[model samples]
Target: MTIAYDWLALGAAACWAVTGLISAPQSRHLGAFAFTRWRMGLVFLALAPVAWLSGGLQQLSLVQLGILVLSGLVGIFIGDTALFASMNRLGPRRTGVLFATHAFFSAVLGFLFLDERMGAQALVGGVLIVAGVMTAIAWGARKDESHAFESLQGHWPTGVALGLLAALCQAGGSFIAKPVMAAGVDPMAAMVVRVGVTCLAHLLLLWSGVGLARAQGTMTPRVLGLVLLSGAIGMGLGMSLILLALRHGEVGMVGILSSVSPVLVLPLLWLTMGRAPARGAWWGAAMTVGGTVLVLLRSHS
Candidate 1:
């Protein structure tokens, strides 16, 4: 049933929420590029066996494999690194809200490239989603907020720019993979290709002797554990769900559902940080969800 992909999309959202909660400290500890590289390596190691055992690698043509590699480069490598960089500067909650713009990007890209129709209702939903993201970023922080998770790192504008870049890359990567997924590629196999290529790319970057690409902190056993867990849930489970959903669902609808990570992360942040989100956070999350629902309704109609 179509509802099945909806559940998959929601599941991916939940997974990403948990991932963000776990990843904040790790991102801070390792720096964005290093953290993403480590995370991708762990995910690739864990998934390679499963994909090989399932014979999913045999399902792809060279062209499909090439697309998956590009997806990994854009989505996992660049998008993920930008995401964690934004997270390091802006914290998880704010980054999540900004990253929610990917839903709007996905919808528009779907219309332009996938022959997906965007009616008036969907257009309105897209506007609301963008407005909600801007509203949340502008007022999401409280003056009295003293938690590490709420503190700003580097430049706020830079963080915002990185978050938007991550969103665009996320949508672009998914759009690139949609056709391949629709062609009956195995989700696990596709993940292996994507993650493997990404992991290799990270290795090459690290080996290139770029100071910015090097690890910012010493790797501890605790940090390693956190990275592994984050990668397992975030990339291993979360991304596989996206691929599966893409196999059967439209890009816009799947992106809208998965973008609920911003809402889900609020409670997780509250639980971890021992305080509720700022008032603007709740309002922005509400508008985003409302927009998502509107879009879904239009899709069904």
Candidate 2:
């Protein structure tokens, strides 16, 4: 089950990577907060049947309901908002490198808060995965002329601060969900609760005039399709897979695998961008995959 869940986490990572690749341009046009709100709304609609088939809201206790809602707020709402803001400040490359810290945050917080511990080998594996991802992203990172990097000159500190906060929120949200998932909550059902709450929170923000009100204007057919695909793959499936992983695997290990999206993005880049990855990128991706395998093997043994 641990091995299976580890693979599932990896799959989730791949799905998220694809989501990032496909939806980035659309997200830029729509604004991150607006895009996310629309994407989650789509995800809510998509997951409804699955949630129903899985016995959905009926499966959760009052405590579980609260935890899942909190998890959604912290993870989807706060963390994602911070992440998009960080990307706006820092380029995607810097933000991507910073995002690698999430696994470390997960490991540390899991230890302190959940009493979850990784053995030395697992620790080494986790470190290697993070290092590899950072290397891969940073090595190939080019300046995006589109984002007006010069304008962000003095704002780097703000980006760094927001990036760290995003990482913390991500890790913290997972840790908060860990106990509930371990208590036998179905991952699919839990996802429904989490996404449902997140959708409502985003709606509340919209109602309060905090979120942008240009959903109809910004969503072209192409953009809407991309967003729907992203929501289906990333928010709908990827999130549920992570939850399933949390139920069956160690938090640190699952976090490590799930955060390997940058590594997974390499091949996609090659295929789409018409350039093979640099040797450093290849080496980094190899190291990340090797580390994931090592972690899974150690768990199995």
Candidate 3:
């Protein structure tokens, strides 16, 4: 079961990596906020039918619905806001490095709230995983761009604070959803509720003239296709896999595995961009894999 969770988490990571590729240009064309709004709306539309068809929606109690909604608000809404803010302040490379702290935050919060304990091997593995991710983000950026170091010129303290808060909120949101998933709620049903809440929240923001109140450009076929692809991979499939992982494995471990998106994205980028990944990127991938093996091995032992 735990192994299944690990694989599911990896699948989720792959989905997110695909989303990044599809959405980056699309978001550039449509503006970030507007793209996100459309993406969330698409995810809701995609998941709602699945939930209904699978009878997952009918099995949820009111309490479970509430948990999922809250999780969505915190994880999707608030967490995303903080993440973007941090990115604005620190830029992508620094922000990516900071965002990797989410796994550590998830683990520590799980221990504090759920009393989940890890063995020494798991601890070492977790640290290595984080270190590898950070190294990859920081070093890969240096190799990939001449202007990468320029992104570090912002208010470091504020960015760091918001980044950490985002991490905590993300982990907390996942932790809150675990008990309901453990209680036999279908991951798809939970996903419907979660995505529904985020969609509603985004709509409210738009309605109130708070954020992404209008479309950035006329929706073209290319933009529409990219949006659909990104939403399907990142939110529809990626989020469902995450919920399934949380159902079958500890949230902390799942978080760590899912955080491997940076490592996973390397080959895809190389293939698409017609460039080999930096040596640092390869090292990062190797370390991430080694660490994951250690964590899984120790957990089962």
Candidate 4:
């Protein structure tokens, strides 16, 4: 991968990490679903003007529009919703650990659906990444060794399931977006279409699942501002960076870097929480991160 793409991928990860902090307060008050729904809407509202100004709005064909819109729905709407549910259940740190599994998930999905080929290094890296995840979250059995079985006992099945859904959603979105972005539409129009679909999907979700929360009241200005900030960070900024990285380098490289989110999350958590994981979880996190790094290195050369 080129240095520019490396920076872009890393930058995307940082913005996404910061977004977790931004969205936390809003999720606390508005609830995750309610917060995500509004965040999705406001993001498009904020992105639309910029997209228009960039003249990204004027360059769309019907087919590109459809694919782009679908990309948004799959990625932000479904992915974000499932992710929040998983995060709530698993906590950001552990959920992040699961999310680090994204490289593997994408690989699997592509293998099954797209017939993508994985060379030896890529395959090894995939194994290491999964092992790293297992390590990062692993606990112990009677021998007090890191036990996969113990890690499996954590309150994260639903989180893992939802995370898997989010991973697939994001992968699907990225897959669809390739042609759209490559088709050379207005970048802003692309943004608008992407977030617009997210907005609509969130609306449907709110109507169906967040009725009680929605009826509580619209968000306060501060809440809305923060949610919008997160949406900008996540969708506007984070995803944008990913697209840029793809333009500059290999998707496999970017995907591997993305799996490093768990490692990034740990320091963020350590700073935020003022504590480290217990020995087992700590070791698990280390191994998981190391494994991910191994995977990245395997492909990088």
TM-score of each: 0.92, 0.89, 0.88, 0.79
Which candidate tops TM-score?
Answer: 1
* Local accuracy of candidate 3 as per-residue lDDT tens digits, 6-81: 8898898788666665665565456555777787888788778878998989988888888899999998777765
Which candidate comes out best when scored by lDDT?
A: 1
Cα-based RMSD of candidate 2? 2.9
Task: Note the clash tally of each candidate.
Answer: 0, 0, 0, 6
> For model 4, which pairs clash?
56-186, 56-189, 132-288, 135-284, 136-284, 136-285
Ranking by TM-score: 1, 2, 3, 4
How would you encode candidate 4's per-residue C-alpha lDDT over 52-121 as one tens digit per residue?
7777777787888888878888877788777766665555655665665666656665566656665676
| lDDT tens digits, residue span 39-63, model 1 | 9898888889988888899868999
Cα lDDT, all candidates? 0.86, 0.78, 0.76, 0.65
List the candidate 2 regions with Cα displacement exceeding 4 Å: 88-92, 142-157, 211-217, 299-301
**Candidate 1: misplaced stretches above 4 Å?**
119-138, 289-301
**lDDT of candidate 2 over 210-293, digit per residue (tens):** 635345245688888988998889888888888988887777777888889878877876776666666778778878987887
Clashes of 1: 0
TM-score attained by model 3: 0.88
